[model samples]
Target: MSNLTARLRASLVAALPPEQLLPDSQPEYVRSYVYVFGATTLASFGFLIISGIVLALFGPGWWHVSRIGHFFNSIHFWSVQAFFFFMVLHLWAQFFMAAWRGGRGITWLTGAVTFVVSLGAAFTGYLSQQNFDSQWIAVQGKDAMNAIGIGAYFNLLNFGQMYTYHVFLLPVAVAALTTVHLLQVRRRGVVPPIPPRGLGG
Candidate 1:
């Protein structure tokens, strides 16, 4: 076991050298405003997570009735809006740049998957609101879930289940996927600039 653990540690260090994982400086190409969107998305997501934890700790009534809870709820809500806004900007920038090029395909795929999973998290969040708005959304959304034929397992009307997903499952998935995507980026580095016209890519 000691030998195995040493080998594992050695392998991990080799795969993720300190310089590669946390470089002192980034490449000149990475200074563009377009690249800034990715970091902005992460900032918004951090706020979403902190506010979400507070809101979850206090339960639905606290968020609905208490002033502090309302403050946290508002924080969570605005954070969600900012998160999606910046995430979309980042995604679109990556798409336009064809960020999958030059061996970054898996990085691109992980980011795309994270975005899709985040959408589910956002939907379930609305269902977990436990308000009249949540009621109407749940009623309307359940049919869509049913039409897809996973209603038995993913019933949108079940507040408990939806809350579990919004507060736990989907968020975990998004965080994990985003972490993996960032790791891949740290390992593989950022995509290079496109070549000028008539200069082969």
Candidate 2:
């Protein structure tokens, strides 16, 4: 364990350098509205995770019955909504910037996959709510899932299973995927935009 930790630490130090990792200096060209959107989107995801944890710990049904639980539930719901909102904006920005152009194609693709998985996670979460909306979505979504044969493995009508998935399984998968995606981003570095053709003087 100690050796692994030392090796990991060494690798990070080699890749990032002390100054860049804890940044006393930044590139002048890094200034742009585009940069802010990435940070904002990340912050929204952080909010969602924190709020979701609170809801999970309190128990989803507890919120409907208890005052504090209800408040946390509200926060969780708002956080989810905020997360989706920022994610959409972030994706649009990346698309407009043509961010997939360089070796950063992996980063772009990984992010796209993560976004798709996040949408699934979000949908399953809503279905697990066990409310009127939950019932409606379950009955509606089951047809699509059944048609695709995923319903065999994932039963939307089983509240117990759906709840477990939303609280534990789905989040774990998202966390794993996000970890890999972030590692790819850090390794590849951010992609620079393509220069115009025939611009040389």
Candidate 3:
């Protein structure tokens, strides 16, 4: 047992050194507004998760009928909006900075995957709302989903199924992908700014 534990520790250390896992400092270039957007995106996601949990605890129908529930619903709604807003800024900033330059392809890939999954989560949330908007979206989305042959397993018209997806499965996927993306970011450290070009020789 001791030998197995030692081997496991060694492997973990080899993959993620203490310095990389918990850095005390970062490069000076990391202070820029562009770099901050990534952190902002993460903060927004955290808030969205908290607000979503509150809504889930009270049940979906409460949000439509109770004053407190309505307030939490608004919070969840705006948090989703903020999450996407910050995420888009982060994506654009990383693209311009060429974040995948330092053999960080997996990091970029995970972030992109998280964004795509989050969109699916947002769509399911809309479907689970049990409101007129949800009805319209489901009616319209069914055609598109059918064209892709995915409507059979994923029925957008089913509120219970959509609620389960929005509150459980999709959130789990987004959280897992975000965790992996952050781990890769820590492993690689922040990407450096492009150096200024020299005057023509």
Q: C-alpha displacement of 48 in model 1, angstroms?
A: 0.8
Q: Which 10-residue window in model 1 sums to the lowest lDDT?
A: 23-32
Cα RMSD (Å) per model?
1.6, 2.9, 2.2
Which ranges of candidate 1 are over 4 A from the true structure? none
lDDT of 3 by residue, 42-84 (tens): 9888988998889889888998999999998899888899899
Model 1 C-alpha RMSD vs. true structure (Å) is 1.6
Clashes of 1: 0
- Which of the two candidates, 1 or 2, achieves a greater TM-score against the reference? 1
lDDT of 2 by residue, 1-201 (tens): 369988999998887675554555445655678756666767777877887888888777887788988787788788788877877887898898787776778878888888888888888889877689999999999999999999999898998888888878877777788777766656656556568788656
lDDT of 1: 0.91
Worst 10-residue stretch by lDDT in candidate 3? Answer: 192-201
Largest TM-score belongs to which candidate?
1
Per-residue alpha-carbon lDDT of model 1 for 118-194, expressed as tens digits? 99999999998889989999999888889989897899888999999999999999999999999998888888888
All candidates' lDDT scores?
A: 0.91, 0.78, 0.91
Residue 152 error, candidate 2, Å:
1.3
